[model samples]
Target: MSGSTATTTPQTTIRIPAPAVTALRDALLRPDGRERVAFGYCSRSGNDLLLTEVEQVPDENHRHSSPGSCRPTTACEREFISRCTSRDLHPVFFHSHPFTDTAWFSTLDRQLIDRFRKWLTTLYPDRDLLFGVLGHEEMRIERVTADDSRPVAVDIKGEWELEQPVRPTHTAAPDAPAVDTERFDRHLRAFGEAGQTKLANTHVAVVGCGGIGSILAQTLARLGIGKLTLIDPDEIEVSNLPRLPGCTHGDVGQLKVSAMHQRCWEANPDCDIISIARPVQETEDYLKNADIIVAGVDRVTARYWVNQFAVRHLIPYVDAGTVIETSDADPPQIESMEVYIQTIVPGVTACFDCLDRGDPDQAYRESLDSAEEKAAVERGYIDADIEPEPAVIDLNQLAAAHTVSAVKRLALGTQPPVAFRKYDDVSGDQALLETHPNASCPTCLGNSLALGDSTISSAADQEIATAPLDDAALANPLEQTDRTTRDWFPPAVTAFFASDLAQHPTTDP
Candidate 1:
């Protein structure tokens, strides 16, 4: 697994978490050589296709393999199938090209898939075995059928509790470029095929769904960025409607990502959008494949994390926000209004954190984590929340538009480095930051390690997802996972919880 790089999958994608793949790699790449494992978890999402959760089964004894081949021993096979029967999961066969960088279903592999698929599908005919091949530098996964193998593009999601994302997974065929030149006729005239293909193939990670974020998402969707990974933890509140598109009065209390997802799909149905209703800290893996990360978040701590990740992974990052300060001296006049957009390219430009390194005020504000700061307050460290800045849709839109323009130009290879920019509302002045990277700066200097070489430990630990023991789940390629966790829940289960709560109202008799 490596850092984020945007990619597209046709119809099927098997997503494994970074840690599971790391663990699997550690096991398979032991000083001893080639191995096979009844390794992962299996859960079905939609009726025919969606796989909401596919994890590495976390059992140690459930594997066997010999040196040049990955076929499981007869005893391990039967034991794995029996375990899957008990666990109630579908299984996928997982292995690797140990001796080489390129791996595929050799005649032996196809035979193994055929035999293993028959062994289980004979009992549960509706199930088929999905096989995956991991190589030294790349990986591929496919759904195997009786006569043909359909490549199930491999993806990795979860809180990336490791140095980088799971290794990049390559599929056989990516989607054809959008041929509706008539739709983008005007844009075609402006940027041409090189620009068109770049936009079509690029993935942008949107890190918020607030005023600026919402606008950015909608605008980018309309512009046809091929894939979008939208991350935000807030739900739609009544106040959000005034500033965010795709947010209605009816959307109140629903996840912001939900609204963004619906809006993105509506704008461009052909685009692939994955909505993660969580903060960037919890879902950094999504950023692993993102070509550009557009952040519209309000929290400085979260932004700091993004800054660190972007530099560490060598991903381009852009963040922008708007603010209005009002004075209550008699008439409550607007004191100052401003918006800023900052762009950071790992080795090319100054890092966002550099701005805070010299100033105590800025550094303090950047260091504050609302939740952690709240805890600190209880321990008597801080006195107040960050001052609330009024937001206007107009201001938000302006900031988003400028950032979007910068992105479009950058993608088309025409924009210069504008590390930071400020627009003054009162004076109607635009300012560009001209600071150079500090020679000793951590993000872009000589000491800054290249992508994936940073020895920093993870911000969080990988929580093992618990699933029941199923024969099919045991036979899968990756690992087992249940969607019914405190942080993540399937829609059906969410609805059930709501209904259950309503029915079991606490009555004081």
Candidate 2:
């Protein structure tokens, strides 16, 4: 378990929030040198399972306890199973082998798991049963089956030190490269060969395929990222030709994602690129599997939705935008031209809500129907035709580069990305500012943080649509999420992302 670096291609992965992992580690790896057990209730999102809650079995609840083996009382097991049933969550059992160097199930473990799996599956026939073992060197999880078991990668979100499961055979070797060493010779130096392989395994989702987003897609492809998911509901326009990479007059009227997909393919033929010609709100299933989200959107509502999704799923988010202000006069005199970049590491750094960047007025207007919007415009409540924001290619490229650099840090496990970066286009000056999570922020704290698919659904979007955006909402943009709770599915519930599972999922595992 403790060896040189390696890479894995596990089909199943379990994403645990930082706090839950910390709690489990502390409880299972006790100083007493005795075996300990904990149970995690998981929520499924595509092939990835998210640990929503952890329950540590106390010493009093153990029937037998020793350094080599331990067993939870039948009553204790039933109690936790009851909790899982109440919440309609899947159960994953974890235990520690304090005396062992590598983690593996013992004979006692096989007996206990067989007994528990039989009892649990009878109650929930379709659900998968998983067992985890934490040894002195590493932790491993396997899905229990009638005949045998298969490895399930354990990914700790918000904590980079703990590892994603690496395939037993693939170790780090700079001289022996998996990718085109000549094409990425420069990359291997900055990121070691293992890091280069990590890039080849990372999946990034670009939420807006306009301006900066188009640049991000092409750049990431050129950087040898293994997968890219491009999402946007817009088609190309004549005016967009200047900002969109690889777009020409002939490509006008085509979907932005399609254009970017073709452009990215030309950049890296080996990289897998998925094009979704729809709003990010309609593409939550795809977003769930993304290793990182790069949002370069201008709409407040779109940004809000992306931020909420990232926070709820504990995915790293890079939100970048350009701001151009002009003074109102006979001629509009330029006031400021700047770009801002925020790297949101859920449960660790500040989120979109922590910065209070949402515009309630715009979001409310966007939610209005055609008739209601026309009435409001006629009543002078809102503008009938809002002028488009000014944009320039140089500013877009600058923002895209900064955003990609943030993703590079996350992919390579080098260091924490900068919390916030600001560049003055006119002054040619840049600054990196530090930011902390807001204790009261609903998006990244107190709620939604690591809630995973529990916080998302078609119903959740309806909540965002119907939320009251009055003075109270203006004070806190995401306060409306308080009303968007999703009920856990019934025993026979269908997979929410079942329809979209045909496409390739993220390759982080």
Q: Give the number of the best model, judged by lDDT.
A: 2
Clashing pairs in 2: 8-167
Which ten residues in a row are the worst by lDDT in model 2?
167-176
Global CA lDDT of candidate 1, please?
0.65
Best TM-score among the predictions, by candidate number:
2
Per-residue lDDT of candidate 1, residues 229-271 (tens digit): 9999999888789998767888999998889899989998877
Note the Cα lDDT for every prediction shown.
0.65, 0.79
**RMSD per model, one decimal:** 13.8, 10.3
Per-residue accuracy of model 2 over 123-222 as CA lDDT, tens digit each: 7765668888877666677777765666676666556434432222122222222787888899888787878888888899999999999999999999
Q: Work out the TM-score per prediction.
A: 0.54, 0.81
